[model samples]
Target chain A: MKLDEFHLERIQSQWENIVDYNLSESGVEPLRLNELVPHNRLQREILETKLGYPQTNGSIPLRRNVSSLYEGATEDHVLVTNGGSEANMVSIWNMLHESDDRDEVVVELPNYMQIWGYSRAFGANVKSFWLTEGDGAWLPDIEGLKDMVSKKTNLIALCNPNNPTGATMKEEHLKAIAEIAEDCGAWILSDEIYRGAELVEQRTPTMWDYYDRVLVTSGLSKAYGLPGLRIGWIACKDEDKVRDLWSYSDYTSIAPSMLGDRLGQMALEPAMREFIEKRTKRILKENWAAMEKWLGENEDIMTCIPPEAAPVCLVKYSESIKSTELAESLIQEKSVLVAPGDHFLLPQTIRIGYGHDKKKLVKGLSLTADFLRGEE
Target chain B: MKLDEFHLERIQSQWENIVDYNLSESGVEPLRLNELVPHNRLQREILETKLGYPQTNGSIPLRRNVSSLYEGATEDHVLVTNGGSEANMVSIWNMLHESDDRDEVVVELPNYMQIWGYSRAFGANVKSFWLTEGDGAWLPDIEGLKDMVSKKTNLIALCNPNNPTGATMKEEHLKAIAEIAEDCGAWILSDEIYRGAELVEQRTPTMWDYYDRVLVTSGLSKAYGLPGLRIGWIACKDEDKVRDLWSYSDYTSIAPSMLGDRLGQMALEPAMREFIEKRTKRILKENWAAMEKWLGENEDIMTCIPPEAAPVCLVKYSESIKSTELAESLIQEKSVLVAPGDHFLLPQTIRIGYGHDKKKLVKGLSLTADFLRGEE
Candidate 1:
């Protein structure tokens, strides 16, 4: 479909390059090469290999690693994409069987725009299942989801831990979502890009385990902090579906770059996989603790939904100020970047990435706080 | 919009891994890192860099070099894609304005499938302007092209130093094509991925030099023999169109890998850019000479369109065997891989890549000649 502007990207592009505190980003502050690979080994190997088109799916080792993220999965079930964005695109692209009558695409609201945008672009009727923020927890509205699914539901899309609000769906909630889809013989697509970044030791239930017709997409962009790698995959999928998606891949990116394939494989290599995850977990813990402490002192001006997972969370401003105005002023006057709530159409909050450098997050919050206090 | 299979890829997947002689490939034998970069210097820098996401458009230097290939284009006129494949996707993507009556996409026959495949998938009617092989020249039938264009044409796509045929469209012919598009107010998309691979020192005029609405796509893949990098760009004369295509980039591949971007910039860097092109030209010349000699000795079995540019050429087998069957036997019995004409929908021909190692080209041609002669 011919689409005209991509608003979220246009807004993110403004700060992707210019800001010191890029809290507008969905992933953590990117890791250095040395962080993912030993300086003397994979780093040198990454530069030495023949750079040609990688396999249409992905490297065997990388896919095998991804398979370990789920049960009963194999390399044949995966198609590595450019990022979770492409993973998201191809999943809907292959699953979409559109007719005028039964065309409902159900997704959570205040979500990653790609889901609804792509579902709508792919010629589906979209309906939202939303989340509510209460007592520092952002929980999915179960009754709303139940109402959204039916015989008309062609697809049910979920992102957990969710973007913007940073909500994680537990096993019980995931089972309920799956049962609803099962009742109508509908497909479920779970975007678990933020799965590994949960603050506590609590694990999120993956769609791979939840539904037979489920498609799960995650990548190095988020928890692995290698957004630059542009490596992601779709899994718990049928073999024919993977092959079918690879065809659309021909008309899309063809394949991810070999260099990225190598780096992603390195990131997923058994020896260093947990090591890489630990680095992000460490950063998340430090930044989250610092932001929470800072938020406690500044409770008069703002409060957060306190993200349990993912790198970022939403902060609600007590001042009667538009989020867009505060966000613009923060970037313009203070050179700080925080996505305004209105960026996601939430008028009173801004999303802050607490997985950034502790100093940068604190300084960014301090400047934002000063701006809000002055407004008061 | 729902596509079932990618036949050529499915066939190649069977042989891309197992074959020793892969003439089915579209590009020259891919370059090793040492061939593209000085083993001592830029190699270290590529590995040492933070590998952060690259600039949304492309690196300044890479875009600058791409701009140089055109007459009056600049960095702002380009959008770097995953490869020529995505280069093709986005070009068709941003140009079409769909209506049943005026939605024709005109392309030359014996062309790469994506130009037509993606066009049809995106809801546009595809029309072909025929090409003829006569007196050792693969000429775009100019009169036929004239008949193909009308006011209803939305886009005309061409691959100069064409795929399969390796036909190079000259400046005069390119201008004539532009005049046709101009008469109809339609856009031109030139896939010049094989620009520097001319066998006889002849050059293909870029579409950027010919038409106002033309979008020209090329990359490190075909001509430079760096297909692994998956780096390609589209150049149009308009800046807003480039910006508009970049918006679609968010939903497509998002961006090329940071390593690919870095290596691309390194490939196009003033110090080493010419060295990389020189390496591919050297291989092309050497391999082309060997294939021409082999074909001379075996004219009884086959004839070729005699490609002027690009690394691969189509060989018309005199035998009555179906192209797919011959290609299948060559791969299965002889461990050789040549693209069947049926892959592009022509039965009595197979495309052989002459940009491989000189020994492999001679060997691959010899084995195919022996096989065809034996068939007779």
Candidate 2:
């Protein structure tokens, strides 16, 4: 039961609110309740909701809405959870528990570190492959993934539209990864929380279509900009596997908040879903312009491979200071909070979240750039 | 990583929603949102809440309110979680992780089995002591607990105003249990979720005053009838330990829902807290009359030690049928859902929840009595 600290979340939980500019968040500026429920009729329904426990897995309407996002799936294929974090926790816990011999887990790196820390705590022998910058985008090292998998690997954990780097694996790459997992008989746990907040028009492809054993985890936190709801889900083709995962949640948190389930269903209804998606894209599009300008201005001291999706991008800096030290300096001297690359196991870099108030983000970036130049 | 199914929760989760009379719930009839937020000023604040992540541990106001329930505690001593279930999950997970050599956990029974299953799944050597029916009350066997503990005992888990049986441990019993735990240098995890729902005037005494190493887990779920909010917390004397537990939550569910924190603050505000407590007592007092009448009518076939607290009482039946079989028969023949004693690790009994609509409670009890007498 010994566990290593999940430094990425630890640092944020401590400093995100304390700093003047919190560039540690991975989602866009959130929507207010009034904004989410604009109509009087729906607001009445929400207001009348009894503060009783919702269905442990999810309300049928909520699960039905979640299932609609994926192709040819239904409510039976989904198990709703507190957030994308628990979705991964239950999936990995189940995968490890289901097999007596498969104690190994292969994880994709330069990603959020929840699964990495949890898997290791649960006694899995964890291995990793990385996504490296190349040819104007962050590319998966598929060859490395192939070399890492074996009969012992029970799960291949992934985060697409990845954290920090904001890299999205192509459909072809997903298919290749699925093929490798198929050969070794490992389940693919693809985290698609950031799939909808793309910089481009085309939505990022899900790993659902690529593998029969895939369990895709996503939520309203990132793409829909509703982290306050704490709504997330896991969708698998195997109904029995989904039921088994639902049982595991009985130990974690019995059920999602009743309001979360109701509000989440409204947020995912066709028109409302379209509205939230548009808001995310608009925010990203607006903020990315400022982010690009900031990067352009700081090219002398820093550089970044532009992110394809999500509110965050990893900026590599040319500095002798350690990533944690730089992050500490930013908090102490600049009153800014950027996720320290050291926490993500990628030192000499920092992850910047540019999804809030544009003016504040620009000012925060300017202050960070000034600090990098050793300016007053 | 292997886990036994939490049968108590699994059975309720499957049938609670489908049953015509759901006596499976442990709390009173839930309050509507309008009832909770009756004032226009507070309703405005709720409506304006941005759908963003609240402070990870808890909003300071929420923690302050939670700490107010215990003597000489502050926000520094609290860690808010999704529910009392996760509160237990984090505490047991932390206890097992804190020491490499101390792996033994002793639990109180028959009780809610969350920690029993979770501690075992985390590789602890779990043992148990029980409360037996005696002197017209359910009493803890203090000597049995003394005999069970040793140097390797890392934790002693207890539920006060205990589940299933609704027995409240006296301060003397709690002190005795604390002494035994102190001899073994073990921490005490007291699930006090049912602390305030007393049938008698005096509220159940918490273990906080009796033990230094105790982590008391309680929430709005049971006593306050606000399970839909999914708000719970842990209170400990050590601030560092509270912070450590918060870090562990980073990998589970990162934070409680935003509205949960905000509305939870309102719910715990002195005036609102008193109002909710009165409501619970009123409901419990009224429902207990019906429950008592039914027990009197059915004394030929069944009997129960009158509950001291909570919305539930364990009924010992004279039927030869197993508890699970009796529960299955009730569900199939009468569309009623009562928690079977087999799920609580005690047989020849069933736990009945009589906290909702009075008419339904009377009807459900009548049907159950008819079944017992073979008079249908």
Q: lDDT winner among the candidates?
A: 2
Clash pairs detected, candidate 2: none
Local accuracy of candidate 1 as per-residue lDDT tens digits, A289-355: 8888988989887888778788888888898988888887788887788888876667898888777
Clashing pairs for model 1 are: A51-B228, A52-B228
Q: After superposition, how far is residue B219 of candidate 1 from its true place, in Å?
A: 1.2
Q: Which ten residues in a row have the lowest lDDT in candidate 1 chain A?
A: A93-102
What are the RMSDs of all candidates, in order?
A: 2.1, 0.9
Query: Which DockQ value does candidate 2 get?
Result: 0.80
Model 1, chain B only, scores a TM-score of 0.95
A309, model 1: CA deviation in Å?
1.0
Please state the CAPRI-style docking class of candidate 1.
Answer: medium
CA deviation > 4 Å runs, candidate 1: A1-4, A39-41, A97-102, B39-41, B97-102
Per-residue lDDT for A12-70 in model 2, tens only? 99998888898888899999999999878877778889999999999999999999998
Range of the 10 consecutive residues with the lowest summed lDDT in candidate 2 chain B: B367-376
True contacts kept of each: 0.62, 0.88
